[model samples]
Target: MTEAEKFTEYTIPRKDTVYCVEFCGTETSSQLLAVGSNSKVSIYLCKFREEEEVEEFEYEQLHDLQNGCRVTALSWSPETSITCLPRNIRLAAGGSDHRIQIFHSDLRGNDSVMVLEGHTDFVNSLTFDPETGDRLASVGDDKWCRIWDKDGNQELTFPLSAQGMSVCWHREEPVKVMVAQKNGVIKIFSLSGQMQLMSFDTNQVPLMEADWCVGNKGLLIGAVAGSDWVMFDVSVSSRPVERRQIHVEGTRYFRWAKCHDSLVASVGRPGRQIKVFNAKSSQTPITLSQTVTYGLSWHQKLPALATGGDQKVHIYMFDSL
Candidate 1:
């Protein structure tokens, strides 16, 4: 690895296998992130201090809530766009108990929790509408995609062709959402009419993940299936316009940079190694060959990445990945 590929990692003090991690994408919540390990999920406020001598990253534990079960997925509400001490924020977490927990915190220790129960099996993924933040979408082993309002009421439930793996909303068109299945089928749903807008297949079995390109305003689709990552231009074709092998062992997930059209990241098995690539040039300049990793995410604005393995949540800043 070159010097630039060597990541400057800042570790959180928590010690446990981090199963899921998500950086808050809401406006003022840029300094916030959630780390789920064991049976608890903790939110932290990060601060960077620069001095003439050195620079450091400081962390403040805001809310540590009991999950009642292992957390499978996490999503931050878009309404958490304020920076204040007495701040009220919402976070939606899917748990192994097959329930959706909406944690309403006010920067205080207490939590007003609302549990949305419908999934008859493990909840694999959960996401909040980035535009309105008033709706939550989830996919699960039950082979169903459930949509709920922030108030915990079920608004819609659609049957998936197979076990749901991942789901995310289009950043540009909030009413449109994408759902990926373990059977390799990817579908875009229009919530306005509760209808299918588009559908395609990876051709490779067991699709692992799918994410909308927020940096590209959701015009592009990115997914990894059977160790191969593919990109689709929704306006152009039903099949991937670009495809490349990212991991030989198997890809666990693929995430697009929140603010860059060219940057992408993924974690795969055998060693749980993480790699960052440029989608435009088909180049992977930086790769982290870690032993074990469960979660990976990017900063809302910067090229920074936060990943969990061992016991800590480590953050990597590109600064000038």
Candidate 2:
């Protein structure tokens, strides 16, 4: 397998672990990188310049959220174009305090905003709809998947049999959402009917994360405990189309690349290895880093990747495989 070239790494000092990292905004608009750590979330604006030699990120601190609880999940609103008004560059973060804090910043970098309260347990995941950016889907240890409108009003709630770990919205269909649960079940819900459409069990292991492929409609990837991953095509069959045991220890996080359809990155705990795999092939993966990686976020517009773990974040740029 071809290895990715390391670009740069940032060592952010934190008292606790960085649980999540996300790229806020879009490539053409105001872009910021949000890092979620224990009890705090930090935002950094990555300035890019096009030199003859290369393009690099110059990080500048934008804002800090001292939530007094662990920041677990983060989501950025999609960029919109209304030339007369200022861009509503907003970020939503779920904390261990059982609250979802929404932070809004303008082009001038003002980040003071609002907070939404509803969940009773640790909020695990938060994602905004790509189409309208008006609706948000959030899941938590409370075993409830909630949908909120632009005003932060609870539009609907679906109760699950077990605690929810991650939630994501379909890129093309705004009304569809998939939630990964602690009981190894991935449930798909329709916002129009507020009802469950279907569910799949991935080895009956706790499914920690799930991501819908950006290029394929029915393709879904899930990371389970014991370092196992399963790819499911909901439109074709209930069974998994591909399954692989990447890590012998355990895997808590995995994400599909934003631009590449066949590229997927996974982090294995107790092993502290980051691997990039070509999903279309079962060959040996290219090991990006040996350091433990807790969270990963791919640049929305570029072919770059950022990973957070062990009090540091590493950025890498890979050649086309």
Candidate 3:
């Protein structure tokens, strides 16, 4: 289970260097979308069918840069009309312009559905509540974490010491959200404004990204300075949890796979590498050799993976033995 694996690789073939990526939900798996310095976003629909292990071909592009922002961070909405035909997926993206805008694929002009203005700095991360799509958590260089009611205008803000680089929401409880600080401190708080539950320090390593595993029982955190990853059992910590370092290569983004277990994915330097690990594994994790890797996301309904890095988006199949 530790052998390095390369599923599929393709240069997204973009006009500029890519910075971020996300997956839009489909009836079975999901679609891959990416953003770049060209100030444009590219959406590549995933084409998967029965007995398929990888993507067959790139489907039609949803929307080009003609309307969307540079798209620093993108998230797919889980809430949609069940009776609607060709279900329209909703998405939220934030970028260098410091704006959090929402859009629905069914809308004309790709108009901005909801424009959220609060962060004084660039919005770097966005995460939707898995339980209820009515709420979202965002982090930014403003050195704070903000939670906004997906259906209302009330946003709860929590200030931290360092610049906010990334954010994630707990799976079971929609109110708990995690914020990663550029200074290497990871803080967990409740959307109810209860209190900061746990905090972990990475010795100022400056974690550019982080995520909490489903059930909110475990957390996976990565840093830039130390080419390593850390796992924390938040429930075991009284005030602040001491992070357990899972030594690996330089990691850039941290994401918890949407699968049924504590599966996690990361893309980082030292080279264009993608690694997947089981939080419950007593042994170490297995790294996948990707020609270039940047973003990692899991499918909602299938054992499929969507990743980006080189020049294109790649789709892979994941199965546990």
Candidate 4:
């Protein structure tokens, strides 16, 4: 590993085996939400400082999804977007039932806002357009990417040849959604009035996760099953501008830090390591953990990280820059 690939400091005892991790909150107070296969969700609240210990909170019983459906994906509403209110912010999750469920968080508690049903196969992933909170996208094993209004109305549907695992909105454009399929292809299409622009045959490996970086100038897509991750300069071309292949120790989960341009985290392999990388270089990844990690997430505002794998959820603060 090169100098930049060497992370400075890290927290100990990383998360155990987890199903998913999400970063929530506005630009100020941030929190990490993790979902476990054991039919529970864990919430960790803390300040971001690197390498320091952080206070943590865990919500193991997410009574919202009553049927015990696993949370396949998560998203937060834009603070300024009128699509959802502060207390009325919405979270969308898909699962084995082929349904998309929305949970509303309020001063009273978290409750099911609505359940979207239509897909004929397992619902795999969901993406909310931060630019236009009204629009949301979902992909599934049925090989179709569907767009829905926040109110649960169907907008559009695009068919692909591979299983759709993840989808994301372009930073500079709200109407455009980038759909990642298991066959290693990323399709970009508009979800505004009609299905405007569409592109296919984007990749050759199965894509497990797709995320937009800090300002949307770049996009990160990963296929942890194959230990391959790629970065794209949105303004340039459909081809990835950079790519990296890391040899993870075990079954991997690939994710980019929520609000950071240079940090990506994953839990898998030899010892459940949290590997961090600079997107600009795609060099040898730096291992950042001393324990097994199942899932990890970055805070939107603070420099801290929240991870959950074992029976305990941990919050770690980065001591300094």
Candidate 5:
């Protein structure tokens, strides 16, 4: 009858607090999971196996890597291929040291990781371009959004009006990208000409994070600013179409479900209480309280939500209705 009772839950125990969670899917069948924590990033291969008539999700540790510093944000590169037997995977992780590390691993004993030197402040977020995983987009407290190629070369840099909070690639637009600044301004850019396409302001100042909707062709964008989360319809208005408060002190993270257009997840500070809400609804359907939590991520295909907790990674699958 209860929201949490109608779902299945999975947990991964770690030695330290998890700061971020990212799921990567492969054509070979299994899914790869990346969880970032203190000075290390743990990678796992996850899959759903049918036990009796019920489907059960399972994961196996594939890598326990030393990141050289506390990882704050992470993104999976599009170059990952699991169609062959060896299974090659690439992941980019940003650390507290204000650097980005690219981890290239495979089953064939050719595992190499490289550090990307950029951003004078702590890296806040990073995402690989959806069209070609070769390019990586990132934002940080350094007031810049920088792009890097697969070879670890910094190719482009875009100065921000404030501390850059989040950056993401448009899933549908091959050359479109977005950057959310802490001053509550959101800018959309065209990668082809490296020209600013559009810019909009949130309902309030101090935006913490923002995400692009998957179901919309980069039309709808969501962000967490101040104590409220707002959604912007770029094609319709220069302002947010929806804005509501879920956090009292402040909201930290905001993520739209990759598989669903109207579903979203957010983390509020003060207590780190996470909420799952429908875009059109005022009431949140599910809430999880983790006094000390860091990030929120949605499963690549399934209707599952994952979050980082104190020394653990928690995954939940609930009926969005």
Candidate 6:
């Protein structure tokens, strides 16, 4: 296993805890990052300066949105360019105010913004479609999953039996989405049919986070409440093909490396340990840090990782095995 070397660290200029962080572009065109903190979302522009054969992150603070509530979820639209339109960097965020807010970089510092209201409680997650970046999916504690168009119109809403925790779009199939619920069930829904296509039951504990394998088809990874990690192969069966006790306590965050097919990262309670596991093997993980990590995000284009906790964000560079 290859150890990840610490690249750089930036301390957020606030005393509040950071709930989430996300990159604003793909690996090929990433330009900004959005950080979700208490009652606001701050934007940072990723700048690079080459020094002694190393590229450093010189992120500049662009702006901050006062959401009037705790911002819990954030997602950026896919990078695209059309003939007649200017380049747009769209951001979607959900918060405790029970509304979803959409912002565009082109219209920053202006009154041109859209807010969609549907969830009755705190929204937990938000994800955009990979193909056209028009459709967005959001889930919340109110047991509702909603889909919205680029124009901020509600296209569809589904009522779930359990509270929703996270939602993710398939990398290859745009119409398919996976939603993790509090009752330990991950359901895959078809946007075209507005119906659930498949469901996987962890049956261990509540599922807080789930992500699809970007490099593999029909493979899913989830973080359970009992400090366990489970991998499911939908093409084979609904049951998990592999399960392992990841943490001594509970885990709430899980992210798959976009460029590495075998590497998966997870974080949990009790300490500041982040573990990177090989999806195909049951060997010991390559531990990253000993600091309490509340948030984890991987750069889409580079082998870099950003973790937020302890009032600071640490960046790391690693070589994928």
RMSD for each of the candidates? 2.1, 2.9, 3.9, 5.0, 2.1, 3.1
Q: Candidate 2: give the clashing pairs.
A: 39-69, 39-70
Cand. 3 TM to true fold: 0.80
Candidate 2's C-alpha runs over 4 A off are 1-17, 25-27, 47-56, 80-87, 107-110
lDDT of each: 0.83, 0.75, 0.63, 0.58, 0.83, 0.74
Task: Give a tens-digit lDDT track for model 4, residues 28-129.
Answer: 324434344444444433333332354442332323334366655556655422223444445676766687776665524645557788789987777677
Q: How many pairs in model 1 have backbone atoms within 3 A of each other, for residues 3 or more apart or on separate chains, i.e. clashes?
A: 1
Error of 6 at 131 (Å): 1.3
* Top candidate when judged by TM-score against the true structure: 1
* Ranking according to TM-score, highest score first: 1, 5, 2, 6, 3, 4
Clashing pairs in 1: 16-311
Which candidate model has the greater lDDT, 2 or 5? 5
Lowest lDDT sum, 10 consecutive residues, model 1, at 47-56
TM-score of 5: 0.94
Writing each residue's lDDT as its tens digit, candidate 1 over 131-173 gives 8788999999999998998688999888999999999987788
Shift in Å, residue 123, candidate 2:
0.6
Candidate 6 local accuracy as lDDT? 0.74
- Kindly state the number of residue pairs that clash in model 6: 4
User: What are the runs in model 5 whose C-alpha is more than 4 Å off?
Assistant: 25-30, 49-55
lDDT of 5: 0.83
Candidate 4, poorest ten consecutive residues by summed lDDT:
56-65
Clash pairs, model 3 backbone? 11-311, 11-312, 12-311, 12-312, 13-311
